[model samples]
Target: MSKKIISVIVALIFILNSIPVFAWTPAESLTSSSVVLMDTVRGQVLFEKNAYKHLSPSVMCKLMTALVTIEKTDLNAKVTISKNAASFNGLNLVVGNQYTVEDLLYAVMLSQGNDAAVALAEYVGDGDIKKFVRYMNTEAKELSLKDTYFVNPTGLYEKAQYTSANDIALLIKAAISNNTFNVIFGARGFGWLNGNNSSILTNQNTLFWSYKGVDGGKLGTNTNPQSFSAVTTASQNDKRLIAVVFNTSKESAFSETAKLFDYGFSKFYTGVLVPKNISQRSIEVDNVKLDLSSKIDVYYTYPVGDSFIKNISFIPNEKLKLPVNTETIAGVLKYTLNDNTVIEVNLYSDKTVSAPEDYRTKIKEIVTENRDLVTIVGILGIIEIILIIKNLIKFMLRAKKTRTQQ
Candidate 1:
């Protein structure tokens, strides 16, 4: 075969043999109800089964209520029980008993008391239950919880009380961010304010005892949906993850969560930032070279399967058309399985920068001009070497002629 034809055939063969990676899918049973396991580092869903499906969050909604309450009120503040606040169909605070906001949180969350939820809400909302409900729904919207709608602070059987597993996960993520809230969630029990009786608020989540590195979370139940969800954080070695599981039978919730947790730890890995102190490099802006790179403490949030090392693909713009500014979000780090189950980690500037007047056009023009200059310089360098060699020969010949004359 001709050399040209042989080269073309080899190139075609290489292209044909390469196959795209496949994504990992969940087993059949897990698909019936929604399930989502995310790596907090990359914020990527490691395994999702009907992740967007809407279902009642049950008492898991308390996680959000607890968060809102924590935001508005101090734990040490005094809570005065009202007629309605103390008298709920399930889990009542004694009609006249006074408690601190912290104690009420334990009752509402650990004891799963609807009355406690109301009492705390009234205290935080300044005796307005409707306004508290408004806060709940508004905050849900702020979190971009598409299918979540809260009718009451307590996750009771209400007409519009519903949330997806994904929505609950977001709520849990927000709650765990607060250090005080984290301590509340993890505690096995709390003391009473009136010195009524020290109630040991055992976590309904059996997984807390069974699972290794299990930080405490919330659990919920209702008749229509025999559901329970908990936000758990577990650690093995130095790697840790926050996992949330929503809407499974009470009998099955703990076991299934264990299964999910085990599946996550066994199938995936959390890695530390490579080269620990390595910072992101800056991109060039118009004429003025500005350093936009951030010192990111990044860890891979994905399952590494059996192989401890995983590949993260950082895809920058093929051409830098986006303006470099502090607020501008550019590029993404995509972590995936051998098969393409993709999750994105964002790249942001560590410091602020101002774009040149003609931002978009200037960026495009600069990239094109820079690339052209580099190519021109590379070619000129080769030509310059050849010219230097010719000049050196001419100088040597002149020196030899002078020697001959001497």
Candidate 2:
């Protein structure tokens, strides 16, 4: 072969080799075994990989612990640390120390204090650790988490104490709904002072350092399974994203979470599936027409350049009864994507349609409707009566005249 032909062949081989062999998939660049990205506002999953795989959440369980504590007890209440709680090796809490619930919560979130977890659990559970664990499981069930079960409040590596990446993301969403929890979670660091000593507690979640728009998150690491997990929330352009990564190295957890955030923000955006003022049309029921109420805007987070509005269908309720009251629900607008119902909203009537009037009222209505025709008929009847009377008077006068002539 000529030199030019060989050069062309070599160049083609290099280009082919550079192309990826497998089709592109989400979280492909991450080392985590399970990952999920969720749009909190729309409650939609933007990306996932084995998101339901059950694994030990380790210290990440503190999220639930903090949530249960904050919800069930007053933050200003003081908690006396117990010996069992202080025995946890990594925590700096002292036995018999008294700290406010708010202080312990900050310690648990910012410092990842297992001791604080125990103290809060004990205080919230009224000194029963088992009861607190049961509360955790109950809350998990209430959230409809199928792949989660908490064996302890501290998430101290019980084989049965496991949760999925998706469940953690869901729990985070619920946790953030509370203003108190949300504020605590977002804190970067806090000052600490007790009777004996004072120290600073810093947030361990590395996303605050590496990623922009990092609002809050939790981190976990366990040696039993050699797993690391992280859940983080970030916001940009008036949109917020929650990302969870499980069963990865400590360093990879934050990195993978950032990767998920990047994917979500770059590929997806909030769009209106159903616009406000969706319909100006009227619906007829029982010969009575009624106008529709103003429509509500339904939003969804979807892939860029994809249109979901076209797939929306407005279907009036077939079983609508007569005499529909104003602002009553008369139908539903359903939005379906890929043969699945994504969003649905009730449609209401703007005006009432009263039932038909009674027979007497109906007769009066008919007369009023044909007033011109009734007036013409009345005039013709009066003229006929006058003619009859005139004929009768003429007959009587002729009869009298004939008798007199005879």
Candidate 3:
């Protein structure tokens, strides 16, 4: 081929390669009554379909129960199953048999144990499961979840107890935020803690089958009222995401949650906006150059082939002062998308300097601190000056008398 023709072809290929192979688009084929895909790392809703519609998301509410349990009690402590708990339909809990709180947590999340959740509630509530339900409602209120209400820890179908997809996502994020709770949620299978009832139990969450980086998930199904739901957490390349689906079929719950994860993961790629401890820009304070940089890495998620603009501003415009230590705030760094601030970090100075004005101020402060000593020194200096003046007068008179005698 001619060199000119080859060059033209190469240029065309390069231009085409720079474009996205597949453009970003909203997720489709989702039939769940309520759905939400949240970027848990940033806590932003990446995708949603009727996310706020209130419905019975069912057993996924065990996530909230597990959250309360981890916060209020010890995980190593053993909880004896009660008849009320043992009467529940799942996990086959034996009345008066003791199980570690940690094991029961696994049951709550993995084994789909209504009995295990109730047992945990009774122990944590001082033998009153209703009190634990109250605790869950209180926590939901504190978390600013307006659509969540709890009537039981087991997540059994109740007309009075209901939650939205958004609330369930929030619950999953909160539940996994704790290390212990996260471990329990991530468990694919766990053996019984009791020696007599020892048997390996597998997690009912189906996301583990086809999803990559699925850390943990929960599936809730109530056939009596025909409600099915799923909450899933997964991570990819240091970014974590949560997906919640409600009012879907039992099989579709898993598939729909997986689809949400796929959409959420494929929609964005992690990019380091600015490196840590490297100067993005600089400002001068009292003639000392202040290189502005974040103490930690500044990262943001964006669609593939997308670009961003950074607009950083120093707040109060006066924090930039002399005698700046390493800990001094240089300014606030803001990363924006479409004019909305996605994240704001406090920029710090890599240089320290003391201005002449600062030194004078410092001296004044020292003098104020030791005013008595300063006063004594001032009086002694004035007395010494007066003595020198008197000696000079005597010497001048002696010199004049000698000249007259001569």
Q: What's the lDDT for all of these models?
A: 0.68, 0.81, 0.79
List clashing residue pairs in candidate 3: none
Error of 3 at 253 (Å): 2.0
Per-residue lDDT tens digits for candidate 1, residues 12-93, read 9888788664543346345236677765554556666777776765665687788888988889887878889867754556
Which regions of candidate 3 fall more than 4 Å away from where they truly are? 1-26, 193-195, 223-225, 284-289, 308-320, 338-341, 355-406
Model 3, 249-293: lDDT tens per residue?
878888777777777677777677778989866888877677878
**Which 10 consecutive residues of model 1 have the lowest summed lDDT?**
273-282
RMSD in order of candidates = 19.6, 10.0, 7.4
Q: After superposition, how far is residue 99 of candidate 1 from its true place, in Å?
A: 0.3
lDDT of 3: 0.79
Instruction: Write model 2 residue lDDT over 106-193, tens digit each, in one string.
Output: 9888775888898898899889999999999999999888889988877788887888888988888888999999999998888898
Q: Candidate 2 deviates by what RMSD?
A: 10.0
Q: Estimate each model's TM-score.
A: 0.67, 0.78, 0.77
Error of 1 at 404 (Å): 87
